[model samples]
Target: KEYNVAILGATGAVGTRLMQKLAESNIPVKSLKLLASKRSAGKKLKYRDDVLTVEEATPDSFDGVDLVLASAGGAVSKKLLPEAVKRGAVAVDNTSAFRMDPDVPLVVPEVNPDALENHHGIIANPNCSTIQMVVALEPIRKQFGLKQIIVSTYQAASGAGQSGLDELRDEAQEHLDGKKMDAHIFPVKGEKEHYPLAFNLLPQIDVFEKDGYTHEEWKMIHETKKIMLNDMNSGAIKVTATCVRVPVEICHGESVYFTVDDAKDASREKIQSILNDAPGVTLKDDPKKQLYPQPIDAAGKEDTYVGRVRPDQENDNAYNMWVVADNLLKGAALNTVEIGEELVKRDLI
Candidate 1:
C-alpha cells in the first residue's frame, strides 16, 4: 500500500508543513520528492530523520509520483496539478485554482470527506477560514439543522504564506524600535499599496471584487455553501462573511453567528453539548472562569477551538460562538495530508 509522493512547493510555508505532516501521518509513503522552483532547487529539507534535496519542478517531476500534495500558488497549481494527473498521480491541492471548478471537490476532511468520492483527479482543500468554521459548525448542522451562517474572520498573516509572516515579524520589531515600519505583503501583495500588520488590523485580505467584498470574503461565503451543502440541498442556507487580516502570527480566529432550523431543541447548553463531542473540535466555553478560545492557545493545534456559545437574545433560532485553529495546520497542511489518508482508506489512489 506504500505510494511514492511528490510535494509541490516543498519549500514554502504550507509546503514545508505538508512535509512535516506527511512524515508524522499514517499514510504509507514509499518515497518523497521535494519540488520547488528553479531558484529553490538544491536546497535541502528534512523529512523525518532523512534529508531530501529539492528538485526543479516540471511536468515530468510527477512521473512516478502516486500522490501530489500541493501548496504552491494558484498559478503553479493550475500549471502543474493537471500534469501530475495526466501522469497518473492524484493531487490534493491547497490553492484556489481548482476549488470552484464544479468538477473539483473542495474538501475539509472532517466536514466533507465523502466529497472525496467525487473527485476526478484533484481534491481541493478549502480556504483556511472556511475549513475551521465548517468543522465547528458541521456537527451542529447535523444535530440541529443549519439554516444560516454569518462569520467575520480574524485571519493570521500566515494565510498570505511565508512572506507575510516574515513581514509581520520585521514590522513588529521596527515599530517597537521607533523606526519606520515597512509594508510589502499584507492585505494583498503586488497591489498598488500595502499596510503594516504590526499592532494593527486591515479589514481586507486579497483583492476587492467589483461587488466591494474582498476575494477572501467571497471565498468564505461561497466555499461554506459548497462544503456544507454537499449531500443536502441546503444551498438555501444563507452565508455572509467579513474577512480581516489580524496582527496574529499563527492561528486564525473567527466570530461566528448562526441560526439553526430546529430552534425548539437548540439552546446555548444544547449547542455546547453537541460541539463538546464533535470530532476535530474542542469546546473551550467556561465564561465563569474567564476561559475562552484564544489564538495563542490554538497555535499549532489540529483541533478547532470553540467558545462563547450563547443564544442570541433577539432571535429564538440564532446563536453566537467563537472559533480558532492554526491556519497552517488544519486550514492547510494537516487537512491536505488527511485527504491523502482518506484516499488511501477509500482505495482511490
Candidate 2:
C-alpha cells in the first residue's frame, strides 16, 4: 500500500505545508520528493525528523512518483501535471489550471470526496476560499438543499502565497516605524497597481475579468456549482462572491448568506443544529459570550470554523453565518493531502 509521492513547488507556502501534512499523514508514503524551481533547488525542507533536498521540477521529475501533490502556480501545473500523469502518477493539482476541466475533478475531500471517483489522472483542489465555504456549505446543502449562496471572502495574505505574507510583515514594521510602506506582491503580482495589506484591505484578489468580477470571485461562483451539483439539471444553484484580501496572516474568513430550497428548514436552530454535527466543521456561535469564528483562532487548524448562524430577517428563507479556516491547511495543502489520503482509503492508488 505504500506509495512514492512527489510534492511540486515544495518550497513555497502551500508546498511547505503540504510536506508537513504528508509527513504527518497516515497515507503510506514509501518515499518523498520535493520539487521546486531551479532557484530553490538544493534547498533542504523538513518533513518529520528528516530533511529532504528539493530538486528542480521538470518533466523528468516524475520518474517513479505514484502521486504528485502540485501546489505550484497554474502555469507550472499546466506545464507539469500532464507530464506527471503521463508517467503513471495521479496528480492532485492545487491550481486553477484544470479545476473546471471536464477531465479533472475539483475536490474538497470533506465536501466532494466522491468526485475523486471520476479522476482521470488529475484531481484539482478547489480555491482556498471556495474550499472552506463549500465544506461549511456541504452539510447545510445536504440537510436543506441549497438554492443560493452569496459570499464575501476576507482572505488572508497567505492566499497569495509566500511573497504576500512577506509583504504584510514588512509593511507592518515599516508602518510602525513611520517609514514609507512599499506596496508590492498583492492584488495582482505583475500588474501596475499594488496595495499594502498590513493594516488595510483590498477588495480584490485576482485579475478583473471583463464582467468586473475578479478571477477569485468567479472561481468561488463556478467552483461551488461544479462541486455541489453532480446532476446537470440541478446545477443551476445561484452563487455570487466578492473576494477580498484582509490583514490576517493565516486563516481566511468568510461571511456567507445562503437560501435553501426548503424554506421551512431554514430556522436558526435547525441550521446551527445541522452544522453542529457536520463533518470537518466546528460550530462556535455564542454571541452572549462574544464568541465566534475568528482568523486568529482558526489559524493552524484543519477544521472549518462556522459561527454567526442566524435566520436573515429580511428574507425568511435566507440564513447567514461566518466561516474560517487556515488558508494553508483545509484550504490548500492539507486538503490536497487529504484527497490523496482518501484515494489511499479507497485503494485508488
Candidate 3:
C-alpha cells in the first residue's frame, strides 16, 4: 500500500537525508511533502527528477500525510509533532524532544522493534551515538544480559548539523594557509565560547551543565536507558558516556566497554560470533590484516560496523568493542525511515 509522507525540517542536514532515503526506500509512497522554517520555504529540493518546494511547517502540514519524518531541532519537534499526530500522522522524530518522555517510545528498529508497538502517534529516534552503539550491543545484551556500558565516542561534525561541517571545512583551509581560524560552530555555537575542530579533539560536545556533563554525554547515558527499556526507579544497567567531537567528517566511531550480567564466563570469541551474524551489523575485527571498520568505510552506509572485540583486561565479564556508522544514515535518516517501515509492517501507521 502507498502512503503520503511529510518531512519536517526538510532543508536541514538530517531532514534532507531523510527525504533522500524516502525517495530510495522500498515503501510505496503516494505523495511526499517537504516542510521547513519560513527562511527555507519555497526552496526547491530535487528528488530523482521531481522538484518539490519546501513549505513552512504548521499544524496543517500533516493534514493528509500518513507518515511524518521529523528531523527538526527539539523545539520545532516539540511544537509541531503533536499537531501532526492530532491530524492522524504518525511521526518518527529525529530529535531529543520526546525521547525521554514516558509515553513516547525511543526506538532503534534493530535494537527495540517492539517499542514501536507502544507508540502514541510519535516515536523518537535515539541520539546518533546512542543509536549505533545500541544496535551493536543489543544482540549481546539479549544473549548475555547487560550490566553496564562505558562508551567514549569519536563523533563526526555532521552530528552538529550542516553548520558544523561547514565550520570544519573552513577551519581546515585556514589552518593549511597558516592563518588564524575563526571559530563559530564547534564545541557549541550558542555557548559563550567556540573552539576549532580541525586537527583537534574537543572533549566538549553540546553545552556543559553545572553538573559537568555535556548535554550530548547525558543524552547517551539517559537515552540508552530509555531505549533499553530500563526502569528509571530500578538501577538496571549502569551507563556512562564521554562524548567527544572529533575531526571526522561523516561517521561516528565509538569505543565501547561493557559488562554483562550473565554469571557464566562468556568469551570474546563467543560475543564476536553473535555480532558477526547479527542483522544491521557488520563485523570487521581482523587486526592481523590491519582490517577493521573505519569512519571512511562506514560513511554513507546503513549498517553499523563492529570490530576490535576483546575482553577487558581487568574484568572477566567486561569486553571492549568498536562501533561505527554514518551519523547521517544509520544514526539519523535510515533509522527514522526504518521506523516508518516497522510501523507499516506492524500496521502502526
The TM-score ranking, best first, is 1, 2, 3
Best by lDDT: 1
- Give the alpha-carbon lDDT of every model: 0.92, 0.90, 0.90
Q: Compose the digit string of candidate 3's lDDT tens values, residues 1-349.
A: 8899999988988988998898788768898999999999889999768999999999998899899999889999999999999999899999989888888988888877898888899999999999999999999988899999999999999999998999999999999999999998889878888889999999998888789999998899888888785443336889889999999999999999999986865888999999988999999999999889999998888999999999989877999999999999999999999889888889898
Q: Comparing 1 and 2 by TM-score, which wins?
A: 1
lDDT tens digits by residue: candidate 2, 2-55: 999999999999998998899889989889999999999999888888889999
lDDT of model 3, residue 180 = 94
lDDT of 1 at 146: 84
Model 1 ranges with Cα > 4 A deviation? 231-235, 262-264
Root-mean-square deviation of every model: 1.4, 1.4, 1.3
lDDT of 1 at 258: 95
Cα lDDT for residue 280, model 2?
92
Ranking according to lDDT, highest score first? 1, 3, 2
Global fold similarity of model 2 (TM-score): 0.97
